[model samples]
Every structure is written in C-alpha cells, then in structure tokens.
Target chain A: MHIVDGALSNEVVIAGSVLAAGGIALGLRKLDIEKIPAAGMLSATFFVASLIHVPIGPSSVHLILNGLAGLMLGWAAFPALFVGLLLQAVFFGFGGLTVLGVNTLNIALPAVLVFYICRQGVAARSAITSAVWGGIGGTLSIVLTTLLVGASLALSGDEFIPAAKLVFVTHIPVMIIEGLLTGFAVYLARKVKPELFAELTVSAEATS
Target chain B: MGHIVTSGPQVLVNAQVSGGNRLLDKLDPRTRIITACVYAVLIVSFKSLVVLSCGLALSLAAMQVTNTPVKATLRRMLAMDGFILFTLALLPFTMPGTPIFSLFGYGFSIEGLMKAIDIALKANAIILMLMVLVGTLEPVTIGHALHRLRTPQVLVHLLMFTVRYISVLHQEYLRLRAAMKVRSFQLSNSLHTYKSVGYLVGMMLVRSLDRSERILAAMKCRGFTGTIPLLDTMQFTKRDKVFALMVLFFALLLIVMEWMIDTTY
Candidate 1:
C-alpha cells in the first residue's frame, strides 16, 4: 500500500500526483470553516488509531480503516489520508516523498468510492443494517486499495506482476478483519451518535 | 500491506528526536524540506550502482552531521525493508536473464538480481536522506514551511490542526485502551475481538467528535477566525545559504557521477 520511493515508474507517480491534487482540492471545496474541527479530529484520531495492533494468527496487523475513514470523511478522505501518509513518511520513515502521491491516491481513492456507495446505507434506520453496509464498504475499500496497489505495480513492469498478485493474496485475511471491525464501529456510531454520517456543510450552504 | 504499522510503536509519538545543537536543526526548515525532496527524486532517477552507493554515503554523512540515533533509524528502515524484501525477492525469479541459480527449478536471472539490488539501494538512500534532513523538523514547523512555500492555505490549516491534535487524541486513545485492559479485555482472532476493538475505536471517534465541537465553541468564543494565521519567525540566514549551496553542489556531483559512469558502461 505504501509504495517506497523508487518502486513506481515516473508516469504513475506524475499521474497520481495530478489526480490526488485534484481530489484534495475538491475535498477542500466541500470543506467549509465549520467542518474543519470534525475533519481534523478524525484525521488525528485515525493517525493514532492506526497504531492499534489487532491479533490475527501467529502475527498481528495494524488497522488501515480507510473504508471507515472514507465513510466518515467522504471526499475529504483525500486530504485527511494524505496528511496521515505525509506524517508517516516524514516522521516515521515509512513511505518516502517521491512515492507519496501514488501512495495517497491508492489509499484514498477507494475511500471516496466507499463514501459514494455506502453513505446512505450507513445512515439506515436500523443500526444493524447500517453496520452491515459499513462492513461491506470497509471490505470493499480494502479490496479496491489492494487492486490499485497491484495495478500500480503491475503497470510498472512485467516482472512486478507476481509481486502484485502476492500482495493481494496475502491480504485476504486483512480484508475480512477490516470489514468486521468497520461494521461494528459503524454500529456503535449509529447507536451512540446517529448523526455521524450526516452530510458535511459544503462551502455553499455554510456561507448561506 | 495497507494495514502494516511497520515502524512499530516508537514513531507514533515523540517524533522530535533530540539533535544536539546540530547544523541541520539550525538551518531553515524550508532548506531541509526542499533538499530532501530534490535529493529523493534525484536518487530515484539514478540507474548506476556507483552513484547510488555514493548517494547512500552522502546520506550517511548527513545522518552523522545531524546526529540521528542509529538504533531508532535502523529499526524504522528495517521495518520498511521487511515488506520490500518480500516484494523485491520475486524479481529475480520473474525477470528473465542469464540463469545464476535455481529455486524450485525456476531460473534466477542476474539482470533481475541487479535490478532488485538497484531498487533496494535507491529506496534506502532516498529514505535515509529524507529522514535525516526533513524528519528532524518539528511537525508544526513543517506545516508553516509548507505555508511559506505557497501550498494551499486550507491544506496547511488542515495539517496544522491535525498536528496540533495528534498528541491530545493519542492520550485519549491510551486512556481508552487502559480502561479496556482494566476490564480484562484481550485480543484474539475472533468475532468478539473485532467487536470490542470496533467499539473501542467507535467510542473514541464519537467522543472526539464531541470534543471537537466543544473545542470549536471555545475557539469561536475567543473570536477565533476560520483560518490560523501563519505566525512563525523562521529566517533564512547565511548559514542556510551555505547549506543550500552545499546541497546543490552535492546534487550536481551526483548527476556528474551518474553521467560519468554511464559513459564507461
């Protein structure tokens, strides 16, 4: 998911940067003054929450929750997740600057897609139904993210195709865990704060 | 891959390393940020092993100059390499070239091996240089430098707010995890585990949302505007100029080495 500096071709990197900038701009447009606190809080929360180590088998995996993030932040997921990746790269040395845009796009695009597909379902009348939808969205985003990461690699070179396939295969278990956790999280949010999925105050309405 | 927190626990907090009054710590944060970016791209573009090794050496020198901790940096770099090794190991098998060896009757190509080594070198050089140069700056200072570099205002604001609140939210997370532990909660691969962790995260998000609302009200009450004005006293002095020139010369030297090696090839 976090492609390091030289792994990606220049074409992929440049295209990713252009598209990610557009997504961030569009997200910023939808974000008004009032929504800053909510967006920023979620950004910081996910940054911290990513440290959670969920045990799987002999090993454990941390949470991506990009689907949950997309469900929570919609288009703003672009900037929020981008900011998270930036911090991780700069502070933690996880991803490097050259690949930041490609990494951001691979992780965040799936998030925006989830927001579009599951926003209404997560706001369903019954908490159970909403959780189910959230679970599906969560799983789907992970799937999409892996696909994008695979695509980025596969498109780079023929030799990378096997590595791309390996990445997706190893993460099937992760996709399930993400789905279950996101579903339950959405259930809790629905039960406790039903307004969690309410539409953000787009700039037009906030000004009016 | 997306779920891996390869850096382990130390990087989540205490991001600021104690640089002992080093030159990197004193140079304008912008200089470091720009140089890191340029050097990263330059290193990535290089195909010569000679240039790559020199680039790595330069980065190591930078690390020494800045006095970055060896153990901490090694741990983080190794974490990244863990995943990378898995990916790059396959290259020798998938790529076709002169057969050097066989594993499971599959030919391992020398060309692919060289490519893998080249990538590993390039990735490590860029990351080491980046961590030593830009990662030393305070997160807030990085945000302000981005603002000064004419990044979009709203994005800068978002970064500032997020950086400001990471510590606060991290503490809240610790408290919730402690409360869960007090209740004898343990993690296992089961539905109950996912459900509880989900609840933990869900509750944290809900509370943080509520907290943000109160925070907004507090700020509004203080006549705070929507945007935080960039208020920093970062000055680019003669020292920064000297450092920036050295960086330029080093970059040019890398390009020259790359070209000189290419002709010999």
Candidate 2:
C-alpha cells in the first residue's frame, strides 16, 4: 500500500514532506532515552512484519500493523514508521526516498490515532474491547490514508474516478485483513506478554 | 559478520561522502534531503521516455562526481529488479497500444513495449537517485534535515532512534530463532510457523518495553532536554550553491527537451 516515487504530484510530495518534518520534531521533543530500545525493537518488528506477504486475490498484501505501532508507541510511531520505511526503501526499495515523508505520515498517523482511541476504550472496559477498538481504528486509519493518497493523486490531474476506484478497491480487502491482524496481534500481546500491555493500560486509564 | 558484510560497503561509500569533516557533516541534513527530494520530483514530472533516459544519465553523472560506485548503485537497483519485472509484465497487457506481435493469442504492442520500457527506466532512475541519497547520508543527518525542513521533531527523533536500534532487534530475532531451532520445534508448516513468529514478536514487544523504560531512566540521569542539540552547524559553501544550481539547470533542460520533442514529432 506504499506509494511509489513520482506517483503523486510535486505539490503533495513537497507539502507532505514539510508536514512530516513538523510531526517528527513534535515526536522527538518529549522522547525519553529509555524509550529508544523499545522504539527500535518495535520498528524492527514492523519491518519484519512486512516481509511476510498474505495473499489477497491477484496481488499479495502484507501486514502494516500501523495500528499496533500507534497503540504502543503513540506519537512515537512517526519515527518508528519513518525508520522502517527508510530501511524498506533502501534495502528493499518498497518505497522511494522522495515520498518517505508522505508515506510515513500516511501509515504512522493511523498508528498514533489507534493508540489514543484504544487507550480511551480500554479504560472503560476489558482488554478485548481495547483490542477490538484498536483493530477497527487501524482499519479506519488506513482507509483514511488511502483516501488522502487518492485525493492527492486526483488533485494532481489524474482521473479522479479511476485513481479513487483503484485505491479503494485494492485497499478494502487489505483493510479487513489489517483489522483482523491488529485485533489478533493485540489479543496475542495481552495473552503472552501482559507487561507489554502495561503502557497501553496506563494511557487508557489516564485518558478515560 | 554477515551484517557487517551487508552494511560495510554502503558505510564506506557514505564515509567517503562525509570525508571526515565535522563542519561539512554538520550542515543542515534537511538541505541535502530537500535537494534530493526536489530531484526526485523533477524526474517523476516527465512522461516522455527520452527525458527519463536523460534524467537517469544525469543522476549517474552526479553519482560519479560524488565518487559513488556505479557498480554498487547498479547492484542495489538489480536487487529491486523483481518489482521492475512485475511492472514490465503488467504494462504490456494493460497499457493501450497497437499490436506488433502475438504469442498464444496474447498480443504485444510496440507502443505498449515502449511505454513499459519508459516506466521501468523511470522507476529505476527514481530508485537509483534515492539509493545514492540514503547511502551517502546518515540516518541522523536525514532526520536533522527533516527537522530543518519543518518535519515534526517527534517523528524525526523517533525515526533516528528507530534506525539506530533496528539491528539490535534483528539480533534479538536471530537469538529467538536460534533458541527455537535448538528446541527441535519444527516450523515447516506455514500456519504454525506464522504463529510461532507472532509469539516471538509478542515476546520481543515485552522486551522492547522494558528496554525503553531503562533508556528513559538513563536519559533522565543525563539531563536530556526534549531536543537533541547539534554539536556543530552546517554551512553551505559557494560550491554547494553551484551544485544546487546545476541540478536545477539539468531539470529544466529535461523539461525543455521533452517539450521540444513533443512539438517536433
């Protein structure tokens, strides 16, 4: 679901880069050094997670887990997503350097959003509810990003209907898959590693 | 050792670019990043195949001037050839064109073939340009560039640390895999294998959280402020300006050339 270089308008690329830069700065301001290793490990997980492709129709789709990252990292997901993307661009060429900022924001924003939503839901009820919220949030976030991407392409003079249809059609199944994956990932975390859920619980408690 | 082997060559290329100068290294990482970003934008704006070829040629020349190894760059591009191959296969069937050849009821169009070639070339050009940028620049430098370019500090710092620790987690993954292997747990079935992988990922998440807590404690001890302070400032020399101008000139040249070709034909 990553947008390749030259696929979008120069305006979007330039403007998106600026916006992403600001997001990164904000993410860095309150970052604690202790969080570095966790960020690193999670970033690595994000990277490795993408390597396993789950087949979807003619084209195969991989798990992005932006929601999971958001739920765990919060705003920290920006940098984690950025690093994972950079590595993917360089090592695997999945995305280009030019579109890095835009792509990072697209994926990471959903993650950050999921973190907030899940935190709120978990405070009022059970872990299962939080997990379900995270899954739904993740799916919605990707859809939002896809729409944004499609809108950007359309604004750049691409035939809006085709571009929108292409993005929406391809991503619907991916979104469902993402929702399931995020739900299961959260469920698995709650089961095998309760400590990992501590931060999410604390954030949820604070928010609620 | 294997990691070193994989990363060493790229590091050497980058070291050469930095040239052991603290001052040069300190220049706004954002400036370089923006320059690269602009180059990518200009390249993708062109639809003509000839212009893309010229753009690729120009990028190669820039790499040469910077002392970047053509072989290494090509090797990296070669590694990503699978995607290019996929694009090539799709283009001929999907792109509109007149039939030039047919095989087993499948028609191949000359126009489609040309367009596919153009897409392939354009894609590679973009990829090569990025490889050079990422290869020569440090992750922190790139992060700093983004900061200067007005990217959110949180995202930049997060990315910086993420790049710093990816290998650490990779090592953790290797250890976990080794342990699993030693226990004689067969991971031959894809479904069972994925489950094991997921569990391992869960364990990794727990370990990562613990590590982050420790890191936060250490940073607090060091009296770290919210922002990472730079030890030096990056100053742009006349040479840097000249370099920037040259890139702009080439981009314009490509655009004009495309215009001329379209009008003439």
**Which candidate number has the best lDDT?**
1
lDDT values, one for every candidate: 0.84, 0.65
Q: Mind listing the fnat for each candidate? A: 0.67, 0.31
Model 1 spans > 4 angstroms off: A199-208, B1-20
How well does model 2 score by local distance difference test?
Answer: 0.65
| Model 2 regions more than 4 Å off | A9-41, A48-63, A74-76, A90-92, A109-185, A192-198, A201-208, B1-31, B69-72, B97-115, B145-151
True contacts kept of 2: 0.31
On DockQ, the leading prediction is 1
lDDT of 2 by residue, B86-184 (tens): 435644544456877776775676765776576566667877766665556665566666666666555566666666665566567678879998988
Q: For model 1, what is the alpha-carbon lDDT of residue A10?
A: 89
> Under CAPRI classification, how is model 1 graded?
medium
TM-score of every prediction relative to native:
0.95, 0.75
Q: In model 1 chain B, which range of ten residues has the least summed lDDT?
A: B1-10
Q: Write model 1 residue lDDT over A115-208, tens digit each, in one string.
A: 8798778878788999999999999999999999999998888899999999999899999999999999989987898766654323322432
Cα lDDT of model 1 by residue, B43-147, tens digit: 989999888989989988878777887667767777789879988999999988998989999899999998898888888888888878777677778899999
